[model samples]
Target: MEQKHGTPIEWLMPLAFCTVFGWVVWHTPAFILDFGPENQQLAALYARLDVSPGLAPLFGGYGDIIDYGALLLSPLIFIGGVMTVRRAPMEFESWRAIDRVAVFIGRITMMLIVLLTSVMIYEVILRYVFEAPTLWANELSLWLAGFVFLLAGLYAMQQRSHIRIFLLYDAVPRWLQRVFDVVSTSLIVIFAAALIYGGYGEAFAKFMRWETFGTAFDPPIPATLKIMVLVIIALVAIQAVINLISDWNAVPVVHTAADDIDQDELERLKAAVGNEGVGELDVTRGAIQGNQSEHK
Candidate 1:
């Protein structure tokens, strides 16, 4: 399929996400330094808490210190969601820029795998070879894992990879399917709204005060993860809305067990593997055909 390129206006959501996440990634070193006790001015500028109406008791006695990381990431999470919602829903095989951003996110998140592996390898060397152990390795890996797991939801939503019960759904009438879509999307939006609204004060307080996980490698991971969750949930809801709008006029499709198999998949795989003479695998006849289509 030919890919459609949108105008400058359509590029805004993606650009916004890139800008915000980019800022956070770039400023991370400074952010960490800002939280250090030696840097009073930077700390004050970045992590000073708005003490009024704070949920101080929630943090187990640490007075509120603003969460710079969460604050920085909030815009990325939001703009990422907006970008997802703005994306035109495409088939799984079709490549588009909107989908490319999700893939971009997925690619970046793959860094966690590298981080986890590197951390474990370093820990092994430290413990076995150097006769030392570091608390930071495990915790840092855990921290990386948190973002990897959480950010995956956005990618899955873009790919429409979430598990669904299609037995009844696929067989429904077009109007009925639309109704189902509306109800489901409405529930998701409601849940996201409630989560944000109900937990706003709590998240705000935690992030505002720079709450720690209380480990030796004390990262503000908890605060950042919580905010990330809220942000992603809102984004998922927005994507659902976009899906509904995009799919509302579509015809309902009924699928049987047989429809689950696609013979062309094997052909594509063979082509990918550089098998020049490989032909389409005819699943029904259980044979490979020289031509792209099966002989009737």
Candidate 2:
């Protein structure tokens, strides 16, 4: 089966969602003032909290909604993007150890962020509407989000989706590309290994301390789970390194024989022909002959 590369839109969806979610979270107070003052649920909560009148306007009922909505949507978007890419025709290529590790870390982080954001959004909404919320949600979201941020490097490595100038890279000899791949992958592996070692201690310490959110919904969810994400990230980072090594020593492979033509070139061809889909060259010949006879 051919692996399908994700369309730009698919890749961008999670990014777009994260940006919007971040914006909403960052500006929750402002949004409340502008659009949510009329929400009775929010007003009542504000009143009960003994919040001053000046500050009351800053609280919005939709804070949870926005927060949770972003969280919920993020993972779905990520999953969708991954599945889309997975379906693309897979092409084997050589990669640097650093590059593979980076891609792996990047993928894991992306998934974690999306999932954590979703969990946060869910907890916030449940708390506001039902007068109850899950302790697990908060802790889960925090741990998951933390891992997501940490795993970014590994994911980037595995996917080989890191940003590069394809035009320049493509122009280079295959042997050189292989060399660059080795150098890049080696650096990534070293960096990720260091992060894993340092991160492990911090994660273990937190677990031992028995950290809790200190909210009504607080639960004794182990900090180890959060730390485990880093461990997994480390593994992914290593895997990426292995992948890079494998690719580095192998010859570069190209799956398709066709040239990649840009939209501009396609459009230029259309313009020259005056209309799109003129069909075979034989069809053009027939049309020209028909026009010539009509003139005669």
Number of clashing pairs per prediction, in order:
4, 43
What's the CA error at residue 131 for candidate 2, in Å? 6.5
Task: State the lDDT at 275 in candidate 2.
Answer: 62
Candidate 2: tens digits of C-alpha lDDT, residues 166-198? 555556888888777777767766876887787
- Which ranges in model 2 have alpha carbons more than 4 Å from their true place? 1-139, 147-156, 165-168, 219-222, 249-296
Off by over 4 Å in 1: 1-101, 128-130, 250-296
Per-prediction TM-score? 0.60, 0.41
lDDT by candidate, in order shown: 0.61, 0.53
Per-residue C-alpha lDDT of model 1 across residues 169-210, encoded as one tens digit per residue: 867777888888899989989999999999888886666555
**What is the C-alpha local distance difference test score of candidate 2?**
0.53
Model 2 TM: 0.41
lDDT of 1 at 174: 77
